[model samples]
Target: MADDAVTTGPEHTDEPVRVGLVGAGPWATMTQAPMLTGGPETRLVGVWARRAEAARELAEPYGVPAFTEYGALLDECEAVAFAVPPDVQARMATEAARAGKAVLLDKPIGLTLAEAAGLAEAIDSAGVVSQLMLSNRYRPRIREFLARAARFDTLGAQARQITRAFVAGPFAFGWRLEYGVLHDVAPHSLDLLDAAVGKIDRVHATGDTRRWVALTLEHTNGAVSQLALTGEVPEGGYTELAMFGPAGELRLDFRDLAGDEADSAAGWATVRREFAAAVRSGRPHALDVHRGLHLQRLIDQALAGLR
Candidate 1:
């Protein structure tokens, strides 16, 4: 895909957009389904998964129909929200875009640059409203932090996201264990650093993807960021980002956000509202497929640099 802008389809009047939830995992059940049903801008029209039973189970309480066929779900909804693995998301989301449904995507976009770029091409060709679920970008606290960080001269940044998800819980399963932190965790740090510091120009990395992965990113504006990520931490862990410069140091911690159910709900609510607004207005969102592709490229670069 070229570095050119992708045009959107024509705008429509403000009406509730019918959205289908794809994937029946914890993310879909906990966040996607609730946010889609709980919000006013979008309606939860249906739920679809690779497994019929899982889809039925998730859609039972919500009173929406469960779809065994992906096409049937796509036919019912004006938009689709994905909560599946990156590879699955790439393929299905491309199909949804080609079917003329606005897409609400999850991060990493795809498992590889080729998959990411192909999805971007499909989105561009379809000219539909598309947005990535970079949830933190929707939070008031994170928005405020970005605003404040922009006013400072950031010389460098340090970020770390450690977790025990691979050890237990709903997130313990799937591609997270196979691909490790780079695909699952690095997207958040990479996306935030690109927004806070500058576009990443170069990436250098070292460490093991299964245990620990560390990266040094040189931003286009010359500010560098160091990131350490792992999902195998045994005890307690944290997600933190700090920047230092002549303006002193600025920090944003995800400690409370990680533990606060209300904060997580609020973030997803804002994400859904904005995505529905984009669909109705035919306006491209800041965190769109193109942005996701850019981050995917950065991830590709970092992966290539890894030893």
Candidate 2:
């Protein structure tokens, strides 16, 4: 399926795109649900989750109906924002796209390359617009940094992300504990590196344990990037992504940014705005399903190398 062939949906005559929230998890509560409810270009019309009680609880506060059936929610909404596990997200996102709904998805796309590719193909074949919510990509400062970095002679980059969330926090899911930081957090770092330099052509990765993984990526643009990821760090973890050249280096540290609440909310709001604009314009966003598939392939390669 061709990139430009994807359409958002039928014209809405200036009405805001009705968006449904899927998977009423911590992320949905903290970010996706709030963004859709408050966003100017989108309206939160309904919510669905595997747990009926959870879905009802999430929907009650917003006054939107809790859908017992996933398809029923899809039927009422022009777009779907997913906050589910990767495997569930892969399945439902494919279903949503096949049903002609625009998709706003969480990162990693799916647990495996095959799953990711299938979702991408489904979205493309159905001619539906899609965007993966890589939070850093939606940050204005990060975007500005990438734009400026593009002007410089390319060299190499380094990214380090250390978090304690997997050890104990609202984000500490069993899947994250099983997969570790490589699968849980590296997608954000990889996406940032790809945006700053170019597409990755190859990857070499290794780790002694699930908690720590490192990767060296060879970008198609001749730039290389090294990433170190861990989720067993001490409280108040560190994150830094830096790109270098003869002009010196540019870097961003999440610690230096605003609090998580404000920063995360703002980032998700940008995601909502971009998704809404894509739905309106029928133009694919830069962070589309194909990009998710590419990242998932890179991740799969890294995982293979780890074994």
Candidate 3:
């Protein structure tokens, strides 16, 4: 293990990991930056972004220096939390991992399978810790539910996410508008489904002009899932994931929960805390880059079917 070992290895120590923030977007400003600054096991030392002015603005309140050069920021910190777009994050995270810096990444690790594979290769080669920010995975309730749900013989599952994210929401990114809900929101649903049920083997999908997408996933464990996603919904749309087995059924209603600011904040805080623990302990998080790649593959399959 090198001095900057990112994954669980001989290089891990009990010292607090120095972390940096990458990307000065809304997500970075609202969640990643604050959580890194306040996390007990991690110190937020620097910030960087493609836009230097945005980086300076974000780093000012924390009294951290904003780096115009991304590599300079990587040099100042042992780990990086990326709040950039999927493509940008994939490129930067690959570089950071190659530099032996641990990475905390956002969902849909990459826009393409090649990018995701490249990131996985970089992380594996560098032996650096990499965690994806799948918000639901960090929720205590969701974790407990998945644990209990996994015990039974999962028969089937259903995940439905209908949101007006593009209509009028904080997640008004151009990518979200262009790609619709499958890329932006389906990753969460798919990740939760994979955790509760099993790995996805194959998928068949169909959708309409309204951006409504329905997918039937065949899980390797003999469990099947129906996932429906759409961004063209009224404000305060519906979101839920239900898994059924011989024992019983378990369902999570994320509609109201996601709309709750306090709950969302708490989820992000837990994500940051767990990420910090991973950096210090060198233990790979449950939602690691490999898992992100798996989800990305599923996303790619679903998108392909849609086309």
TM-score of each: 0.94, 0.92, 0.90
- Whole-model lDDT per candidate: 0.86, 0.83, 0.81
The weakest ten consecutive residues by lDDT in model 2 span 1-10
Worst 10 residues of 3 by lDDT: 1-10
The runs of at least 3 residues in candidate 1 whose Cα sits more than 4 Å from the true structure, single-residue gaps closed, are 1-14, 256-262
lDDT of 2 by residue, 131-221 (tens): 9888877776666677776676668888888888678778887677777776689898887777777778899999943678889999888
Write one digit per residue (lDDT tens) for candidate 1, span 1-307.
Answer: 0121123343333678999999999999888998888867889999999899999999999999999999999999999999999999999999999999999999989999999999999999999989998888888777778888778788999999888868888888879999988988888888888888778888898988888989999988889999999989877988899999997999998985666767667777778778877898778887899999999998888788874
RMSD (Å) per prediction: 3.4, 3.6, 4.5
lDDT of 3 by residue, 1-307 (tens): 0011123333324666799999898999987887877656678898998899999999999999999988889889999999988999999999999999999999889888899999999999999998888876766666667767757677898888888876776787677787777778888888777777887888888995247889999988888899888888866678898888777877788754656776666676677667777877777876789989998898888878978
* lDDT score for residue 220 of model 1: 81
For model 3, the superposed segments whose C-alpha errors exceed 4 Å read 1-14, 208-210, 256-266
Each candidate's clash count? 0, 0, 3
C-alpha lDDT of candidate 3 relative to the true structure:
0.81
